[model samples]
Target chain A: MSEIFVKDRELVMPGDVLAKSIDILPGNGTYRDGEEIISKVIGLVKLKERFISVIPLSGKYIPKPGDRVIGVIEDVQPTFWNVNINSPYLGLLLLGEAVREYVDVTKTDISKYYDIGEIIYAKVLHVSRSGVVSLSMNDPKAKKLRGGKLVRITPYKVPRVIGREGSMIELIKEKTNCNIIVGQNGVIWIKGMNEGLATRAILLIEKESHITGLTQKVSKLLEEGDKK
Target chain B: MKKGKPERLIIDGKRLDGRDLEEFREMEAKIKVIKSADGSAMFRFGNTIAIAAVYGPRPMFPKHLQNPERAVINLRYNMVPFSTEDRVRPGVSRRSIEISKILKEAIAETVFTEEFPRTVIDIYIEMIQADGTTRCAALNAASLALADAGVPMKDLIAACSAGKVDGHIVLDVNGKEDNYGEVDMPVAMIPRENKVVLLQMDGLLTKEEFEKCLQLAKKGCMQVYKLQKECIKNTYKQIAEGDENV
Candidate 1:
């Protein structure tokens, strides 16, 4: 007999038993211990059919493959540039992956392509088991982000900021008339007429992420900003 | 000059602080006390206060120290000059170094270090006030801080001390009892797994008395564990309740 100890969306601490059954598999932020599925962090319990996962409320961002991230160039080597993606590990952007055009390293300086301290919107190509993150800028959308204020929130709250089907982000973009780029690593770039208004709305969403009626609340906040 | 031991520490079935044999000192635990730290907590056992701050799981420096298989834990335990009645010299003392190593190992046992391989998690524990069982307070604070930082772990570590005072097996030895007590044993364990990760004894006890002391200490640890869980839950509750100031 399988028994679920906690209800869906319940708050659980480390070592708190979530279920007692072999059939129910553990997911992210949770692990199996003997016949019990236990939480490995302080997070909200999420149950999906046969899998149970916990969404962490706080922590450093862990890079995953296929994630879009905004990173600052820390060092430019001969063939690669080290990008600080707001994670424990630095993202390596190889010269070949950074630009489509082939530039002879002997003839041209690599730093000329992406210099230090410049922020770029890129994609994580791979993450090794040892935590080495490889990044690429091959996509048309990937480019250097310029003259915009950067705002950071907890990485876990990024989803709430984006909202369902980009409703929240689209709302902010419409109200503030700004082009916003949100990175999975919690780095956000806002560029346009009302940068301050857009930044405030994004932060408000981060602060009240877990509360109910967030969409309505965010829309109200954006409307209030438009008046002033 | 050596101070003489007290004539008796237990009288009328009560210890010096007027508590029973298996009673712990009044404890208080709080998390997110330090704004700058990734995770921070303060734990208090009566007058003894310990504040711990966790910085990383960030990239490790000095390349050779980096472990490809798991993250390394670096813990520092320090006592402020005014923590005790007499001014403790600033900087790491031999006693603090030894305690730091043991507490680091104890905390490492619970953390899932393999999740963030090639990184180093730094834990700094400061003894703001000194009473007896300071190491236990430090361990408690460190564990809470790790959880507050959202470090994945098997379980939260809880620590407390038990000792023999005037031939009575008592829980949570205080500064006065530590000076005059016949035995002092500090124990730290994972409450859910019932696994002891850290244990040390400063004095000898009969085999039967040792068993009793261990049991008393385990009981005290469970109580502390309950308080830790409550402390963490309360912080989240305030945020979930839509507090504008949080």
Candidate 2:
């Protein structure tokens, strides 16, 4: 049997041992050294049946393949568009993968579709070993985001905002009656009725993500909003 | 920058600041002070105040500078013109540059840079006030900021300084003591691992005094580690309670 060293939701710091048994598997924000699983970040320890992981408290987003992200177009080239994905590295959106239709290179204005400063929803196609990001808009769900309240939360807390199998987000959407899109890079878009309430709830989640029983607190907030 | 020496630094086992010879100054640390930065912290050690902000683990600019296997760390240590009694120049100085390099090496000792290949982590430490031992305060604040930013690491770095003054060894030397002290030694370490990352000395010391000073500095750093951890936990504690202000 694997022995857990820390209780669930306990605060852990770097080099803190979370487990001392070989049967215990280490997850993200944790690394195994010898027979010990040690936390690599200042975060909250989460224990599963046979796995242990530490969820970071705060940090910027690092792009990974297949993540859906929202970015702003920074520059436009003939073959590709440079997008700022809220990271140190710039993301590239190739003209060929942006849309289904092909255009004559001699007489096409790509800016009309993705002008500078335009917000776009694109899926990460690849993140190179050198930190170069490649994005694609070919997914049917990906498109230009229209006017909406765009809020940025700590990317590390994205999973918390989403909750188990997206139940938390579903609850927020149902309670506020708003259309919401959460980008893996921490950018969120909210539109429709009760946008303010939805934004408030998201902000709350970002601030209190480390806390246990957060889903209930969010529900209480929404219920109070209903009464008001 | 010179001032007349005080009559005594330690009298009746108390130092100039009313602290015992081995006691530290009043210290306070706060995290998440800057919304714009990925991680930020303000640390105050008595009259010395320093704030550190962390940005990145992001893509490195200047394409050629990217490290394919690990993240590069850039550290900047600066003191405002008004930080001290004299109005120092606003730009980088030789002292600042040297301190910056040493600080970078100290912090790099703990971080697991391999996790983010070809990325860069930028650390900025600004001294808003300076009494003495600003570098130690800055390093402590920067370590907390890195943790606040959630940078993966082996352990948190803690630093403190000790000096010999008036024929006695003192912990956390103030400006007055630093000017006339026989020896000044600043030490940085990974408190959990009990590993030293930074060690610098200026002035003369006997072999026995050096060993004693090292132990004292280590003790001081451990104390700082306790407060730093508490500050980080308090932020989460308030949130865990579902407080609206957090």
Candidate 3:
């Protein structure tokens, strides 16, 4: 039997390291001092700064207090919209949450607030214990997008598109000169770019969303275009 | 799966629409189709493509998890971020977890735990695309996974959903029907015993509506059970036949 030691001194989950490297595949929490393949994300852990944890992708979405999201309107009533937050709990966008204004009840038209198929930019306001969520877009920061084009990728790919602390997206913006906002719900909004660059950027994000070493991959791919 | 927004109407004795109160969309399933999983299956209920796979009845190491009574069943229910028109995230969401839990419970009900007490059964289900009635498709797919694993069960658990849309109870509501429909009910049943193992409904439903939906969902489950059995026998038969020649 072969055994390895954990040299990074970082504790990780079994699934995560298994996904990245296999020196530990037939093993766990074990690492070799040298010749051990470096791991990307450690699934989920309870370690401090010295160690990392990995969270395997599951199909449930629980709205956090301050996460940026993109969602689609599943239905609309006279004063509210039912949003499929892509979570187990459906999201609700009240009439007042859609804009920054006070309207007389006599002149209010709920349909005018949000259409059934429209996409809305939002932030999670409150998640209730009874399995309901309140969403808000009225804050100055929550812009009601009408001019940007939206594209979607898998939710698991968000970390990739955003890159480590927004580095990946920043690189794309710098290279293509495009203003892009990626939603936690897997929606990407692109503005102020030609169709070619925008398409290229979207494809790049989509292709490398779940993969590690994506930044270099994008750079290499884009560099090929320059040479051609 | 049916389409379009559900609208409440009282036209004739008919359901504002022409569908009988008990009609179901086309349901079909296929198994051992995907090359990726150790064991895989695909189930289509109308436009929905629900896939399931079985992996690792192997040891869940750590030298700490080998139970003597039953194997741990780690279930995952995933809606491909593209399962609908809107792209979804490829990771776990709360709803996915809930679905996975329900699936695990449902399969646990029928599986003989003592048979493989030290092993772990991992059943994974992915909703490839949702037209409507995914719960039922998911049940069918999960059953196929258990079968693919060659795990013995008292019976294959079958599931289906029935709901009231536009004031009419329709069997196996499609995606459009679910969004706009007033009531959505999902049920998992064991046909051999005519027993209901899992039942849930969302939206509004009167007592009578709930009863009607329950009966309809059970009926749908039985029909699905037949298909599930056939799918299993056929898949194994095919595999055995192929191995024989090889």
Candidate maximizing lDDT: 1
TM-score of 2: 0.93
Worst 10 residues of 3 chain A by lDDT: A12-21
Residues B191-224, model 1: lDDT tens digits: 9999999999988898998999899999999999
Question: What is candidate 3's local distance difference test score?
Answer: 0.65
Better of 1 and 2 by lDDT: 1
Preferred candidate (lDDT higher): 2 or 3: 2
Candidate 2 ranges beyond 4 A from true positions: A1-3, A223-228, B242-246
Model 1 DockQ class: medium
Q: Candidate 3's residue-wise lDDT over B21-44, tens digit each?
A: 676666777866655454567889
lDDT of 3 at B199: 85
What TM-score does candidate 1 get on C-alpha atoms?
A: 0.96
- Per-residue CA lDDT of model 3 for A158-202, tens digit only, reads 777787888878877777667787878667878765535655766
Ranking by DockQ: 1, 2, 3
- For model 1, the stretches where C-alpha displacement exceeds 4 angstroms are A223-228, B1-7, B244-246
- What lDDT does candidate 3 reach at residue B92? 86
DockQ-based class of model 2: medium
lDDT at position B246, candidate 2: 48
